[model samples]
Structures are given as C-alpha cells and as structure tokens.
Target: MKPRFPIPLLVPLLLSVALAADDDFSFDFITHGPMLGEVTDSTVKVWARSQRPGEYAVRYGTDPASLDQVSAPLKTTIEHDNTGWVTLTGLKPETTYHYQVYHDTLPTGPAGGFRTLPNAEEHREPEHNPRGLFNFSFQFGSCANQNPNHGIGPSLPTHATMRRTLPGKALFSIMNGDFIYEEHRTLPVTNWLSQVGLTPGESPEIVKLAPSVVGLWENYKTYLSRGVNLAAWQRNMPTVFTFDDHELVNDIRGAGTTGFRERRAVFRDIGIRAWEDYAGWACPRATSQGIHFGTAKLEEGSDILTDKDADFSKIDLAQAANLHVHWGTDSAGVDDIRLDAESPANPNAGVYDVLEVLDAHRLRVTPAAVADSTGSYSIGRRSHGKFTVSNCDFFLLDCKTHRQMHDPKEPGKKGLTLLGDRQKAWLLEEMEKSGADFFFVVSSVNFMIPHNGAGGHEFAEGKDEAWTSMLDERERLIDAFDALRKPVFILTADLHNSFAIKITDRVWEFASGPLNSVNHVPKNDEGDRPATGLFRSGPRTCDIRWSSYILPDLERLQRLYPYYCVAQINNVFNMPKELGGTRWVAYPNPQVIFQYFDGRTGAFQYAEAIGTERKP
Candidate 1:
C-alpha cells in the first residue's frame, strides 16, 4: 500500500540523526520516539523505536555533563514493531534528569530531560510541614488526528506550541486518545486539490496490513516522523495516555465498527497490542489483565455476569481467563488475587472447567458474593488507571474498550454504560478515599453538553456519542463525584473545539480542542445556549453554573488554531464578595486554574478558577 502521506524528505532527515561511524548501529537508528513515559520518584521509562531491529540504551544523570547512569540495553524487534523502553532507575526525587538515547556508542537524538515527582515521604499534613503540598500544572488535549492526505497538514503545530509555551513548567501531559486516525489510503475529493505538490510512494514508508501491527506502527511512525514539534514535545515531557475510538477504528464500540461487526475481536486485540507497545506501557493500570467483569451480581444465590449493553463476542477466548485469571479489588494499590483456571483441582471456585459464556451479555460462573468476585469476564487489558503527583490525583477512564453501543432512541436506557462496572466502582472508591486536594479525571470523550440536539434537528439525527447517550450511568457517576464535595475537574477531548461546563458546584468539565485536527464548530442548535435554559439536548436541568466555548463563532472557528489546556493546581487568588465589586479581599483560597492556549501562536486565550471555598 501507499504511504499515508508524502514523507520522502523525512526519510533522509531522520537518517541524518545517526552520526555514529559504526555501520551496524549508525544506519539503523531511532525512528520515532524518545517519548518519556511514567516518571516516578526514583525511575522513568523512555520509549523509543528503532529504524530497524537493534539494541538501545538510555544514558542519564541529574547533571548533563557527568551522565553517570545507564539503563540495561533493550533489544527492539520487528515482532514488537522494533519499539522498546529503557527505564532509568535509582534517581533522586523531584530532581531534573537529562538523558539521551544511544544505539550502542552512537547518540540517536538530542538530549531531553524530565523532573520526577515528589516522593510519598514528602507528603505530609500542611500544618505540620509547610512545603508538603506542592503546586504544579499539566498539559492535556486529544484528537491529534494526523491524516496528512486530508486538509490538515503533517506538522502538528499544537505540539510545538505546547512545548514552547509551557516549557519545562507543566509536570506532564495526558494525551487522552485519538493520537492517530488509522485511516490510510483514503482521501476526500475536496482534498485532492491540496495534494498537487505531493507524489505517491515518495517515501520508503510502507503500509502493511495482515499482521495489523505493521500498518499501525507505520501509522505512528508516519505521524511522528511527519511532525518535528510532536516528536520534540514527546521526547521532552512525560505523557500519560488513554485511548479513544480512533486508535482502534473511527467511533468504535465494544461490539465493533458499525459495518464490520465480524472483525471486532481482531480489531480490538491488534489495536490494543499495538497501543500497548507504543502508548499503554508508560502508565500503570488498575485492571491490566483481562476485561473487568461487568454487571456482576448475585441472582437467586448464583453468581451471574449479565452485561446486556456489552458485546462479549469481542472477547478473545484464546488469550483469556483460561490462560490465567486474577480477581479481587480494582484498586491500583492492591495486588490482584491470581487464580490458575487450568488447574485440574479447580481451586478457583469451579471456574476452571465449567465457566460458561451464554451469549453477549450472560455468563455463568461459580456462585459467590458480588464483592468477592471482581475479575475480567473477557479479554481486557490495561485501559484505565489511577495516578498521583503531589496534592492532585488522576483517574484515567477507558471510554472505548468496555463501552456499549449507544442508541439515540433510548437515551435513558437502564444498562447503557460508558465505564463498565469494575472501573466505576474503583473510581468511586478511590475518589472517596483520596486525600488529594484536587482530582483530574481523564475521560477521552465529553462528559456532558450533548453536541447533538435533543429534538429533531437535522444534524442531531443519529448522534449519541457523548454522556447524553448513557444518562443513567452519567448521572450516577456525577452524583458520586458530587458527594465528594472536593474540586473534581473532568478533563476531556474528542470534540474538535474547546469548552468548559461547570456541571455542579464542585464538579467541572474542561474539554480541550484537537491538537492538530480541524477546529469543528458545533451547529446552531447544538451545545448549551445560556440565553435560554434549554440546550440542544433538552432543558438545562442539571445544576450547570456556567458554560463557555473558546471559538463560539464561525469566524473564529475558521481560524483553525489548535488548542491545549493546562490545569494549575493549588493556585491562589484574590476576589470580591459582590459581582464586579471593587472592595476586594485576599481570597487566599486554594483553587485550580484551567488555562487555555492557542497551539499556533501560543497565546493565552481564556482562564477559569474553581475551588474558591475557604474550607476544603
């Protein structure tokens, strides 16, 4: 197949980076990344892919000159897409460490550095230790669709803007999905005029299908190699990832893509495998084994798994529980109780031999209490997770993997779910127990504010992609968040424009626009219109305090300025008692400032401060 975009210029440009004299190591150098992954107190994972099969290592230290530490050389193979991670361990906490990737004795790319988060030992009561609660910011955005043949350019200017604007201040970035739109060899008729300067097969980049990993790897490399800004930012900052639909297929569900229902399992398995090798390895997961069991309950004294909304057909029975199964709490803090299902003794409450999958929804297993039996019912892996830095906690939800196909007709269906059972339970439990002052929940899709109108608007005919589709589950999750009473900010993307909706007194949803994709303006009948209490979805029944969009008009929307959001936690501000009052007092209240910046010009566009209450 043809290359996704014209990349002939990129080939020699990347090839020139390997300056070492050795023919074996110099020629086969780093292709895509030195992308920083999870940066803990004492360790950091650096992900890189070679141009070909080779061994690589990371040389690092707090001082760039000395560079004493070196990671164990990891080999990159075509089987794993020639990508591997080199973890630098035994580093000091809260210290900045500079590092460079090496193909044997040769330097692959320019040196990049990242600062580790404060250690757990540094966390203490603010009253006892003044410096215990540290303040920091993080950059986040989604839908960096790099379909170069389309109207969008190969250069992801947003990434460059994010790196230059935020510099080294932002702790990390959360690339909440749609990192790549795996659509190759497809172009629009309108975009045909834009392809005049490009030649077919101009670059050596090949698109191979069958194995799926090859094409996906090519897709990542195509995008990464095309954009210098994206590659540069990735190399410098540590990024946590959670995928949306595009990583697998456009608007994919658990069942499958609408037309290709038969290939659901293959798509999910291959998509996730490629994602794991490229993205998921960076952050840890709460449930990293199989798909978390959904609709777990005791029906008439029998343990039954009936998730009517989910498509169990997508489960790979081969690499499933039969190989190995683990049960217990969904918390990332606790170790899962591993059970050998292949054992003849059937020690796992008779789960080895007689585990019956009735259909897409219903399954029969050994009878047990609902709380005691929390394991994956299908082939699910690391999709959702919980992580913490200083005083802020993060919950990254996997919106696509366990998602049910949303029906526009029945918006309030009983079983329609966005986050499946075990994940929801874990999120609620973790939120309740969290001691952090701020919570940043990463949901790749939008939380509320239905993009499609509720009534019979022409544009709203079959749209049910956002939280509006799963009203019941969304409300329940919101209520759980409301009960926390702390400042909970839901960071979301997938929508092509940036907006913020104050969902409740303590809960807010801040969605950033696409990093490089076209800026999509919602229709006239779409989004929340504050003038009337009614929105496109319905009456604004929820306690939404305020709502605002960065590009509210078509004129500004046409500018196509890429966007990203930065949330500054534990910020202080002064405010007045009355509306637009001059007699102001020092608020000194702990707050989170949601700041938006234009990805093209790096200009600060908007800012909103939440959590101004005097007490926690």
Candidate 2:
C-alpha cells in the first residue's frame, strides 16, 4: 500500500484515521459545583458523558495534586438509553474540595477537575465567615435555544471570560427548561438533523432522526454535541434542571389529540431521557426498556376548605386533571361539554386533561374542577422526594391542564381555575410537613402578575382569562405559605429576561429568562423599577442575615442582559430565638455580555451592561 497508494488518497486516509483515533481516546468533562437545597445541607453533584462507553472514574481532594486525599470514585452505568450520570455523597458542608475524573480503561483521555461546596453546618452563623470570607456565588439563567444564531454558542467569548474570571465561584447552575429549540422548524428531518447535525444517509446516529421517538433520541445526542463544553462544566459541578416549552415543543398542552400533544409527550419523555443520559440525576428511574413517569398522590372532591382534610381515595387515571367544571358552551343546549362547570363528575378533572382539550379546540375553559385524587396520580409517577438542591420544598404544578376555552369575544367569562381537591390537599400537606426554610413552587408559566409592557400583550393575548384564573391559585398558595411564616421563593423561567420581585409575607419571586435568547423586552420600562435591581456588569454577592429578610445592596448593578442570578439565604445560625429566622442579602452585581451576528454584514455586535439606569 505504501508503494502503490496514490498520494492524495493516502494523505486524506491518514488524516481521517488520526481524527477518528483522537475522538475515540478523548473524554470531555464539564463541571457544576456544590448546591444546597431545602431540608438538606450543602452537597455537590457532577455530570459527564463519553463518546464511547467504558469504566469511568471521578477523583477529588482539597488540593489539585492531592486529589487522593478525599477523592471518591464512581462507576457509571448507561441508563435511560445511554445517558451517563454520577452523584457523590457524605462530604463536608460548605467546604470546598477539588476533584477530577479519569477513564479507567483509557489512560490517554482528558482528565477533568472541579471544587465542592463548603460544609453548611460549619458556616451556620452569618459572621462565622471562612477565614477569608469566600463569597458564595453562582449564576443562573434559562431560555437557551440550541440554535447557534440565538444561543450561548455565539456568546462564547463573554461566557468564557466570565468562567475564567470566576474560577470555582459558581457552586452550580440550573438549566430551567427550554434548553433545546427542536420544534421551531416544521420539517421533522430538518429539525432532528439540526439537533445532532447529521444528514439522512449518514451514520446510525444520523439516521435516528425520524419518528418522534427517534427524533427525541437524536435531539438529545445533538444537544450534547453542541453543549460539549457545558457538559464538561456540568461534569465537574452539580446541576439542578427543569424543562420548559421548547424542550418538548413550543407552548404545548396535554389535553388534546393533536399531533402536537402526542409529539409533545414523546418530546417530554425523550427530552427527560436525554437529560438523564447526558446530565445529572433525574428521578423516575430509567428502565432497560424506557423511562417512566413518577407518581404523586392526587385526590378528587368539592369543598376547597375541607378537601385537604378529606379522607383519601384512589381512582386510576393517566395524568393530572381538573377537579371540577365551572362553565360550559352549548352548541344547542345539550350541556356543551366545553362550557360545563368544574365538577368531580367529569373524567377530565385534572389540569393536564383540561389543557389537552383546550389545545384541541384552540380555546380555554374556566371555573375548573377542584377535587382530591392523590392515590390515583401517585401510582407509578416519579417523585423528587420532598426537596430539591436549592434548599426549597417544591410542588411541580400542572397548572393549565384544566381551563375553559373562552369565547374569543367574551374575555369576562374566564374565571379562576383553582387547584382541584386532590392537588390542593397534597400541596397543603407538603407545606405543613415541610421542615425546610423555603418553599419553592414550579409552574410552567408566570403565576403572580402579567406583563404590562409593549408586545407583552401579544404574548399574553388569548391567555388573559387563564391568567385571571391563576390569580386565585397564586393568592391561595401565598396565603397558605404565608400563614406558615416560612420564607418562600418562586423559581420560574419562560420570559426571556432575568427578573426578581418581592411578594408579601417575605416571599420572593425569582424569574430567569431564556439563556441565549432575544425576545422582545417589554417596551415599557417596567423592568427599570427602582426596587428591581438588575445585575448588569461586574461580580455581585448577597448575604443572608438572621432576621429572615435579605439585606439589600450586597452588590448592586443596573441594566444588564445575557446574565444569570443566584439567590442565597444566609445567617441562619445567628438567627434570634424570638423571630425564629435568618435573613438573605441579595448581593454582588454581575453582568453578562452577549455577541450576535449583525444581519447586514455578518459582523458580531458586543452587548453588555450599558448603564446603571434602572428600568421604570
């Protein structure tokens, strides 16, 4: 072959072989640092995935060279169809520990490193600061689409700089939904290929882009490929994740029989599956065959006041539904099913069913059912225990599942879609049983207020009635949690901008926007409101005091975009015995810069914290 091979062919062949070999022996590592959650002290979790599966090992120590000191090794198994993950335990709270990972079989692969969180117990007191006062810092933002044109890929330089400057600063990061924009395009082939980047005639990985099922798998693979660096970071750190619209399909509901719903379910299933494959721990254990939905106790009944106290009963059903019917439309006085009042008699009483039906008719329902159906829903569905890493107890609500399709002209017909009897009871139970300091609730959309800015109305046009219904639920939750006097924080993302608001009873709403996205910022300067401190530029930190209230001005910055925010509750150890509490300080202003290609000449524009002026 050496004597007879053509020079051009031989040269190309050699290069191909070299590239393949390099890929085979290479391992990319990402890190997410230690994170603390409700009822739980400080703990760190990390993630990583290999191009090829083999025995993998993670090692750690306080010193880079002495990883042998506290290093623990974990052997990962391929679950949920090839996603890889590892969770470390029994470490000191709040104390930082350096760590690294290596392949047992391949000595030539890359070795990665990261640091763990401080022991929480050691720093229980606000002034019990570390010898030098290590700033507790981390950044979070959502709405990152996989599209290179609008995602983190284009802003690589800014993020890289931030990472370099804040080495070991962030304990963890949360990918609060919309991680991938797979459904924007219409063509299944094109959408699937866009995710992982392979043509139809290419390898099996490429061919696996058809049928919603295969498309999901391909989408996951594609997401991992594009987020190689992110994966590397996650591998070294611990990450908490939740999904948004784009993760499955945009603005999807579960009520209808439309292709969107079916595909959405597939998207959700596969999306979660992909998450498990390439990221951190996802509940609802994965089986060799496929993934399963986790369960929660759901009840059905009337009398909102007594529902929580009602005895439990089980009814077999698929997902969360409305508890009652408040209104119905009559096409000819036949008790139009669409406008029926919220009732336990209806089979589709849960929120999920209502949403499904609404999507089917392109209309919303109102006066939704309220019932108790805990045993029915909990059967087989996945559960995230009582708490998540952010130190808050969470209730993942299926809010829009039950709603009436309002008359396009009668916006007044829309009324509150309260939590059905079952979910309400369950929520109250969780709140009463919660031993954590904070209550964190997750809804797919905003629950408190509506967007009053320009273009905001368009975003919420047909959804106003639904929002009104939500107001009651929001108030109810607040009142319940407020009565407990426990500090609660709401974490939600959907809006493409990062914002925070203080609710009554010391409750705070922290809303993060889509990462790497450019939605129309409400033309109104409402975001500039003085009380709203937007972190535009520079590093900022917040310190929690013992009074159960966050002290303002730890690090204040003005308008900034393309950034992440972290809310930390500190000073519990110094809490006074009478008030029974700790305080939080919103601190350290940090700004993020974004770069995008100008349509005119394909030049990149640099956008950063332009000023300290607050949004009105």
Candidate of highest lDDT: 1
The estimated TM-scores of all candidates read 0.72, 0.56
lDDT of 2 at 161: 35
**Who wins the TM-score comparison?**
1
Question: Which residue ranges in model 2 land beyond 4 Å of their true spot?
Answer: 1-43, 69-81, 105-114, 120-138, 146-153, 156-158, 161-170, 183-211, 220-224, 227-229, 255-267, 279-425, 442-444, 451-469, 523-560, 572-616
* Model 2 agreement with the true structure over 1-616: per-residue lDDT tens digits: 3657788788989999999888655533222211221112334554444433345555656566666633244433323333344555665555566655566532222344445554434433444332221224344456655455444453333234334544565665555666666632222544544433346564243123213334444555555555554444444445556655455455433322211112222233333444444432533221122232222223243222112322222322334233222111111111122322333222323323322222211222232324433211111122122343333455554332332332323323324343344555666787788665456665545444343332333333333322323454556666776687665656666665544544553455565554455442433312222323332111212211101011232221121235445444332223344576543322222122222222213233322121111335
Tens digit of per-residue lDDT, candidate 1, span 77-102: 65566788877889898788899888
At residue 462, give the lDDT of candidate 2: 38
Clash totals, every prediction: 3, 123
